[model samples]
Target: MRLIQINKTYGDKTVLKDVTLDFPIGKVTVLVGPSGSGKSTILRSLNFLVTPESGQYDFNDHQIDFSQSISNKEKLAVRRETGMVFQDYNLFPHKTVLGNIIEGPTQVLKMGKKQAIKVAKELLAKVGLADYGDVYPSELSGGQAQRVAIARALAMKPRYVLLDEPTSALDPELELSVLKVLLQLAHEKQSMVLVTHNMAFAKQIADKIIFVENGEIIYDGDPKKFFSQDNSSKRIKNFIASMTMENLK
Candidate 1:
């Protein structure tokens, strides 16, 4: 997926200005930045969840003008290929684990109940929650909830997944569960863009790291190069210093 000269503004204040970058498919690309740095906006814009004020988005073979009016069908079609995993699990309170995972496919995709349930079961097993299908979201730990969210998104068979601080709301141990599941997806050749503050995990699982400051990409290159840059901006260096393996250990 590619963003070309993208720009977004709220009234007179611009959030992202002329941002252009290419996210390689079939690899993990981590987007790192402090709060309100437009990292989340960039991710949201890809799905037209937050339409940009200007610029073009290039998907596998289609071009989308952020400024153009889009039909609901058009938008949902794009969204199907671009799944989002939020900081909160966003599971339905009344739905069981299996219900939550299969809801979208059965309801939105018009899939049969049995087919959706079959797929949901396979995904639950994939995320290491094979025995939790009958449980409700309220009964699961944060990590389990988040893993279910991942499975819910994956059930749609998205070509690219967008994650916004996936572990932010979890305790350290719970965070590991979510991270381990995502890390395994990297091995599966899942293409994803993750917005995270977990620098240690970024270095470990990301094939590329995009550093953003004040809404612009300051660095977009190999994850190792990001760590070794002597001339790295103070903002980036400071960000790195804040990350510790204490949580990972």
Candidate 2:
């Protein structure tokens, strides 16, 4: 999937300025930047949750011109190809873990209920929640809930999984659990686009890294070189130092 010359704004504030990005298949692309740097906006745009006012979105056979009014069918079609996991987990409070995982497959994909449940159970096991299918969201811990959310996203069998601060809400111990699942996905070569503040996890899993600041990309290249500050600007160096310091605190 690719975004070309994308621009987005809210009133006088520009959020994304002519941003162009590519998400390659079977690779993990990590977006890292300071707060309010438009990383989340870029991630959301991947799933069509936040539409840019202008630019082109190319995914599979679909080429969307954001300058024109997009039809609901077009939006849904693009959305079905990507799964989004947000910081909040966003699980249905009234639904059990099994129900949440099967919701997309049974509703959107139109899979049979039995088949959906079967698939959901397998995904739950993949995320280390096989026994929690009958548990409700309210009963699970932060990490457990996030794992279920991951399973729910994977249940759709999306070509790419988009995650925005998936571990930001949890404590250090709980955060490790979510990161473990993500690392496993990386090893399995599941394509993912992630917006995160966790630099260590980013360095460990990213096949490519894009650094954004003030809604503009500062760096987009090799993670090893980017993290090593090789040929990087003073600004990039300072940002990394600051993030490292923050992590230490």
Candidate 3:
């Protein structure tokens, strides 16, 4: 999957400036940067949650030209190809965990109730929530609820999962559980693009890391090389130093 020269602006602010990226299949790609650096914007653009003002996006045979008129056909295709997990778990309050997972499959995919439930059960198990399928989101801990959100996203069997701070809502101790689920998914060779500020999570799960700031990409490379002490970018160096200090505190 690739973003071909995307450019987006909001009023006087240019949030994304001529950015282009290629995401490897079956690999985890992490986008790390400071707040308001356009990291989340990049993820949203990738998922077509918000179309960029100009550029082209290509994934397999799927393509969208933001410079031209977008068709509902392309929107549906992209929705099928990409799944997004937001900072907040957007589960339905009235639905049980199982119901939340099955809603899209049964309604959107047109799968039968029995088959959808079966698949939802499997997904619940995959996210380590097999026993909680009957429970409500409000009954689960923050970490647990986030795991269910991941399960809901997976039920679509999307080609790429786009996560925007999947662990941000949890404390350090609770964060480990959510991070573990993500690592497990990464091991299963799920193609993912993540927007996060959790440097530790990025280092643990990323095959590739890109640093974005001021609406532009400053660095893109292997995790080791990008995080190496000898890496010469002062901006990224300062970011690492600040995050390290914050972690210690």
TM-score of each: 0.94, 0.97, 0.97
Tens digit of lDDT per residue, candidate 3, span 122-164?
9888888889989998999998899999999999999999999
Q: Summarize candidate 1's per-residue lDDT along 11-115 as a digit string, tens digits.
A: 887889899999999999999887888999998888887888789999977788878876787788889898889999899989999999998898888899999
- The window of 10 residues in a row where model 3 has the poorest summed lDDT is 240-249
RMSD of each: 2.6, 1.4, 1.4
How high is the lDDT of residue 62 in model 2?
95
Residue 55, candidate 2: Cα error in Å is 0.5
Candidate with more favorable, higher lDDT: 1 or 2? 2
TM-score, candidate number 3:
0.97
Q: Model 2: residues >4 Å from true position, as ranges? A: 246-249
Compare the candidates by TM-score and give the number of the best one: 2
Under the 3 Å rule for N, CA and C atoms, how many clashes does model 1 have?
Answer: 0
| Each prediction's number of clashing residue pairs | 0, 0, 0
How far residue 105's Cα lies from its native spot in candidate 2, in Å, is 0.4
Per-residue error for 240 in candidate 1, Å, reads 1.1
Instruction: Rank the candidate models, highest TM-score first.
Output: 2, 3, 1
Candidates 1 and 3 compared by TM-score, better number: 3
